[model samples]
Target chain A: MLNCKQTTKLLSEKQDRPLSFRERVALRLHLIMCSGCTNYDRQMGFIRKACRRIGGDDAK
Target chain B: MNSERDGNTSKAAELWLQEAEIATLRRDMLRFAKLQLRDVATAEDAVQEALSAAYATRGRFAGRAQVKTWIFSILRNKIIDQIRSQTRHPTRSLTQDDGRNAEVGALFDDGGYWHKAARPADWGDPEAALGSEQFWVIFEICLNAMAENTARIFTMREFLGLETAEICTELGISENNCWVILHRARSRLRLCLEENWIKRG
Candidate 1:
């Protein structure tokens, strides 16, 4: 089982590339039990959305 | 005939830089400067200077988009000049990630478990925070707190919409290095925001 440290790092890496099938399954399983990592995942999604919105604002 | 010709040029200048557009454009310039310069006060000063310089040369501005591009160029130069004039802050060094990783490492205990105090709380309706002006102020503070290279890489990927391979090529760093920097930046930003914004809630 991946530890929280590895789980968090993997979640960040997921932003830059597609996680392997096994990796994805492992992360999903981990998030099922790890509330902290689950929250981290959602926060990452929110941050990404925020960045894109602000970046789009610059064009106009 | 000469008065009529002068009238055409003045009208074209007015169309290129309307009074209302200047207010919107200044905000854009200020945002750009703050991201790069990292000091809000300095960023505002740079934008002010750039706008003044652009105003002096406003007659030459050709179109709306052209005026934006032109003023942004001036702002970039102004920031570069400010960065050079000051004794460089060591924190601005690109290789500051090692120090940042050390700080991140402190958050986890030896078996790689989240430390008791560091466990992230569920951020209820986090997107709602984005709607407030205060939220952006805190967000900017968190982004400014990142390591120098990490901030650059993060902004390039997140803000500039650059791909991983393109970033690696542009920065002449290895692909692995690029991912490492990005990962570090992402994690840090999350922690920073959670600490400052979510925890406050």
Candidate 2:
């Protein structure tokens, strides 16, 4: 049972690399029960997309 | 006939150069460099240097990539050089552990769970937000507000699309430390956006 802080950290790491099976299972189990971590994960993805659009024309 | 073909080839090359010049938007490059370097004058110098380099190497451009992409690659190299030089100086220490500690402390409680007030809120229509010009203005503000090294690491990974291993090599930090920095950066940025932009709406 990964707590929200550890779960959010793992979510950020998942953006950079693939998680191992155990880590994946833990995050999934935690996310299923925790809306805060789930929202954090979604917002992190949103921020990454927004960042990619920072300087240039977004149409491309 | 051969002379006519040679003339056409030269014309094509000339047109490509003109298109490249038109496609390189100075303001956009400056914005990106400022975000990465966090210094207005240095960002201007970097953009200037990158443009000159692109102009000098225009003859070698194979025209496979878009002109903007070509210019961006040159700018990236220039920014990386600036980062390397800045890091080599002894006046600026690489280990700024205090900011990182405070950031972590603010986010997590004694039991290592998210502090009650630090929990994330739902950000509505993030795709739409990305398209909005005002959202980006706020985004840049939040990004610029972050600590220098942390912002650099975040932009290097997200904006520049560098792998973690590549970032570690370029920044000369341990892999674990790199992850820690990235985690903190994301957490801070997320909270900033939620409080300043999403929640306000």
Candidate 3:
């Protein structure tokens, strides 16, 4: 039900951890048929993890 | 039995304090600090000093923001202090009219232009790329490319774990304006990295 922009924002927030029930359902519904947003989600997650790993090295 | 209870209580208290300690917030705090000071050692010292203050005043940490966010607020103050304390004066003026600046015109044409900024890739498969090492290069390049102030704001909100409200309060900007600055910073970074790192390959 969420638009691509909202979906993308939620996906970014979810990257930090598990999504809430409403968000989980919304993301599932959105990704079920929307390839672009799904790809966006994946990319966002990748960037976050990459940055965190880089941060991990700096903390040492 | 009483002694055992007291020992357990002490252990629990220690763990609680450790969880709220500044070192626990290092990953993001240092990143934010480095953005300001531009030197890793100086940034680390600033963050360490902020953490010490936070520990001393841990009770003041309103749970409204994440622990990382609270520590970052302290770090910001510390960085400002360090900058203000620097007593060294510049050896030479930075006037552009000096003959030494005459060569600068060659970097651009008579119309005044530099290299066209890069654009982000279409992000063909974001899911597959997330958590990849190559992505870190993009992240670093994009982050570093941002304006110092923009980078500070974004790093504080996203990397350092502060809420938009807290950031706005500290930076003395409106809520909507804070979001705007963050958005611009992210977009610029995305475009810069897309052009430099992704397209190059």
lDDT (Cα, tens digit) per residue for candidate 3, span B107-193: 233433222221123576554454555755566666876655566666655555567777666655666666655545544554455
lDDT agreement of model 2 with the native: 0.78
The stretch of ten residues in a row with the least summed lDDT in candidate 1 chain B is: B84-93
Q: For model 3, how big is the iRMS in angstroms? A: 9.8
Give one digit per residue, the lDDT tens place, for model 2 in B1-201. Answer: 357759977865664555545554786788889999988999999999988887788777767346677787788878877877776543543447745558656777877777777777766568877656677788888898888888878888887778889877776787777888898888888877887888775
Model 1: colliding residue pairs = none
lDDT of model 3 at position B15: 34
Q: For all the predictions, what are the DockQ values?
A: 0.51, 0.62, 0.08
**Order of candidate numbers by DockQ, starting with the best:** 2, 1, 3
lDDT of each: 0.77, 0.78, 0.57
TM-scores for the candidates: 0.71, 0.82, 0.46
Which 10 consecutive positions of candidate 3 chain B have the poorest summed lDDT?
Answer: B87-96
| Model 2 lDDT per residue over A1-60, tens place | 787778988999999888999999999999898777889999888888777665453533
Ranking by lDDT: 2, 1, 3
**Clash pairs (backbone) in predicted model 3:** A42-B126, A42-B127, A43-B126, A46-B130, A46-B131
Which residue runs does candidate 2 get wrong by more than 4 Å? A55-60, B1-24, B59-65, B89-95, B99-104
